[model samples]
Target: MLGAIIGDIVGSRFEFNNHRSKAFDLFTDNCRITDDTIMTLAVASAIMEAEEQLESAAEIGDNNREYYRLVEVLAVKTMQNLGRSYPNYGYGDRFAQWLSSDQPKPYNSFGNGAAMRISPAGFAAKTETEARILSEVITRVSHNHPEGLKGAEATVMAIYMARNGADKQAIRDRINGYFYTLDFTIDGIRDTYRFNETCQETVPQAITAFLESTSFEDAIRTAISVGGDSDTLAAITGAIAEAYYGIPENIKEKALTYLDTNLQAIYEAWQEFKKKRSMNITFRPAKLQEREILFREGYREWPKNRTFEEYCSDNAKEDEYGIRYIMAIDDEILSSVILLELKSIMGKKVYGIGSVLTPQNHTGKGYATTLLRKCLQQIENNDPLIFLYSDINPAFYQRLSFRILPLEFQKVKKSTCMVRCRDENWEALLKSSVALIPDYF
Candidate 1:
């Protein structure tokens, strides 16, 4: 959601001027939020309202048909309400007309607006099927054209897969199989691409921009460099990029400033709504029946030339050190981490977190992050120090307030060692402690 807003603001100045190069400054005074941001927020608002209403309806009776019907109705109402509030936000001719119509109906449009505003559905949905259902419900209120529906569904699915930890190849393959045949590259088409507003022309290029990008900023730059419906292109690309590579804190902070009071409130409310939803997630030690699945998954990370039974036996031995903590909903394990107790150093209790893994099917739902946060809350007050050897990007743990320890404090050969301290004098504590490296998990 913020990703789309950031892209919309950054690309607003270039939408008409067409700066077909990546060397331009990202944010400027001329940059402004447009229809993209408005509709994105509107869609998000409608979804939240619909979900709240659905919960209420579920308490009374089972009415899936009526619940979805309400979603479509609220989508139209919210978009019109917000669109009318921002009358001069550069909405397209047909969309502007639809907004003003008291009895607005689908205009059979296949515009890029459908794809640009569809990202919130991806984030709100729990499964690919729900993602498609949400996309179709919200989009059909305005962009009922088949191509428009396809474009929106494709974008939503890309976000769903990216958030779920699908690799680039998997996303590309799925898009190719169902949505668009991404045979062209950003570099191949940059010189020839022109201003276009249709979804068929816009979505594939935006997706390619994200595919070729190495960072969130790079995705925005690459989308603008294509020189076609710049804001919409970048908004589409930015949504996917944010799902894959989180927006840096600096970028997210700057982007929020562009929103006015009402929009800012909506964004804040959405954050709170999401947080409340995640509160239902529970974390605990892995159950006896679940250890085998954990072992099988862990073996993929560290096979050690051992048979399945040998790997299970070896993992069982680690129970003396620590137990596996799992994040789950109902009976499904979403993510797991090994919590190891290490020998106390300098009279401070030390704990090691390792084998942080989310099953491939559940990568992007933020289960691991929630699990880690729960783990920290469970231990931080009781222990003075906590440590982890990160096998993946250290930035992930950094976001959780872990600092990379100096090389002298590292015990492993190639892994990055990081620590979280409950005390303010942890640096001095580290420097004064004896040269005793703790055992690696």
Candidate 2:
């Protein structure tokens, strides 16, 4: 249900992808969350309060609509709190002031803001009829335009239809009446959508993704394949998909790692809400990757070593796995040192954990640490175990909540040409095992 918000946070940076490839990341230390996240969380807070207020109102037999109105008030207030708390979380200039104080102005700005942030309320509604109604009411607080209302209403309704197990066409037919005129079905979307933006274009496009899928993950991939705002589209789609398909145990499990303690708590609250609705299936009992496959692709046989020029030339190859990583650029040159995603030595399926580096003069300003958290959040999988080679200073890792593992424990039971591959003396070499997590980054 919250997958929509997660999508926005993960996709915030690539809204206008330019020429970069999706293969570029998961980790590195650059990508960051944006206002879509701020606003979505704002809505979630409002929904939680709405639920509480609704129960309170029901006890007194107050009008049913009053409960949703309470939610609208809380939503505006929560959005305002986010502005004051994290002004730099990337709220656009015009909206930032609205988030700062009580005196407010709801924007006529018909951006996807309404659609992206409204998923939470949609899923929170008790029924399809109720979902559409709340969509209209909640949206009026900010996005009151016809198209804006349509976009937000469309997303919430899709999530409602999906959770109830309505088929793709059934859901499509329901919303198509309100938005665009299209005999064009979800299948048409699968066949036609190549790439586009704007809520008018992407919202319906993302809706088809949910309409066409069987699993939450599939819905995400479907949206990603068409491109556009991959994260946002996937997010908007994923929220609905989660309602229909539920998060696969695999994705939800892995997504857990990316969440810091605070995010984790929020996720748990979301789960509690879902449990009240229906049983959800997910990818549980996470799988382990093949060891042989690891030996082949990992650092062992350093891929036909290529210089920077050669590496840059193979853009497609970079997207495949380890080739593309974040870089700090300054003026016309590459600034700061790079954080390499060298092969990971962590538990099976834990993937890679490399260095956390800041470009040259970017040191004391906290850019590297900020980047590390952002990048880590991007790729934090749910394998439950992640290990990394400490950047020379073990102290750095220690600060990030990592405890030093004894070097003797990591050594391979077998040796290479009579030499131990895992250095028994590794602990003597540097600092702690994991790095400290910075406060807000």
Candidate 3:
């Protein structure tokens, strides 16, 4: 739940006394992702087939201690990274105690801590039912109470609905449908929030905030407006809302400002982790595999196309097409761009690879070769016939399994090459340059 961490970090400042509304900021100088974000990631990382992490931890390395030690290491590292020098965000009393502890002592405090901190289960769950089950199982680690378990379950449900493309009403219905045992209406929460303090009351209330939202940011505002555990409430709601609306551009830009340099990098790490995780996940060990092999292939003469370098670097942050990649060195940008959207070409059933660039001085380094091989390695299924057109050297792509075809091959329906690279294909020539994004204003 990277989105939740971002929300928590951004909303931490306004948690208790929220004044600003609908403002897009990564994290206000005062804001930082809390135990919710850290614990959520840990839970997502710890998942195994055995019905429980504690059980799995107990059975590790022919003994249980290794697993516990591993879990403790992850928790400590995540919590340590949450402080000032890294992400530098907010944390409540019980969490601070856990963070400061050299070893994790199961604390029985069943506050919203368990619920507010669990969003990754939504992403990790294979189905809605599985998500709810995982939510209950994981929350029991520290928060054994029914309310604690309920709060975590509700967060998982919200995250699952949002990621699966459910609208606000759909999310609300799913949340309310399962949480019928609790007084779950927005009005009910707002009316009784003055007296509600436990996980049961707060979790559903936070989710309702998202369920009633019009925009991603609106969910956070709704959570804060109700006023109970404002930051934690918004953290849960904002995370689900972000998955629904997809983080707004202005908000993403501003949020990065509040984080120190290390955590700013952590944002990139989170993106990479999620991207690779989605690509690699399968049911059994026999299915587990790494499909893609991406290489940056750093540049020496980066200034030859300085603007292109900056542009490619900026576009790399949002691999929107899910197949686009850029070349960079250290923090400085570079001059290679390959933004190929791996979709089919109508009738021909050919795999398309249009985003190809070999700008100025960077030409001889075999970027095309490097990128092509990497792309092929990444394809485990579906993208069978790779296509591209190159007159300068058909031999280059030919080495990478691409074949040269006649100009009229477009009309011939061949499934071989990745692209029918036309001389007029200026959009494909440069990186990050899109000639046709129909309604993109």
- Judging by lDDT against the true structure, name the best candidate: 1
Q: Is candidate 1 or candidate 3 better by TM-score?
A: 1
TM-score of each: 0.68, 0.55, 0.51
**Index of the highest-TM-score prediction:** 1
* Ranked candidates, highest lDDT first: 1, 2, 3
Could you give the C-alpha RMSD of every candidate to the true structure, in order shown? 12.6, 23.1, 16.5
Model 3: CA > 4 A from native = 18-90, 133-137, 167-170, 180-192, 195-197, 280-441
Candidate 1 pairs with clashing backbones? 163-364, 164-364
> Please, what are the lDDT tens digits per residue for candidate 3 over residues 89-177?
45656656666666656577668877766776676554455566667656665676776777778788778656654445445555656
Question: Residue 107 in model 3: shift from native, Å?
Answer: 2.5
TM-score of 2: 0.55
| lDDT (Cα, tens digit) per residue for candidate 1, span 1-441 | 788888899999999889888999998899899999999999989878987876752221122557567778999999999999999999999999999999999999999999999999888776555688888989998899999999999999899877765546557867887899999998899889999999999999999999999999999999999997999999999999998898999999999999999999989988887786666567789998999898888898878689988988878877778988998877788999888888776787888888898998777655676577667656665545778888768988764657788777777776888877744546655776435555666
Superpose all Cα atoms of candidate 3 onto the true structure and report the RMSD in Å to 1 decimal.
16.5
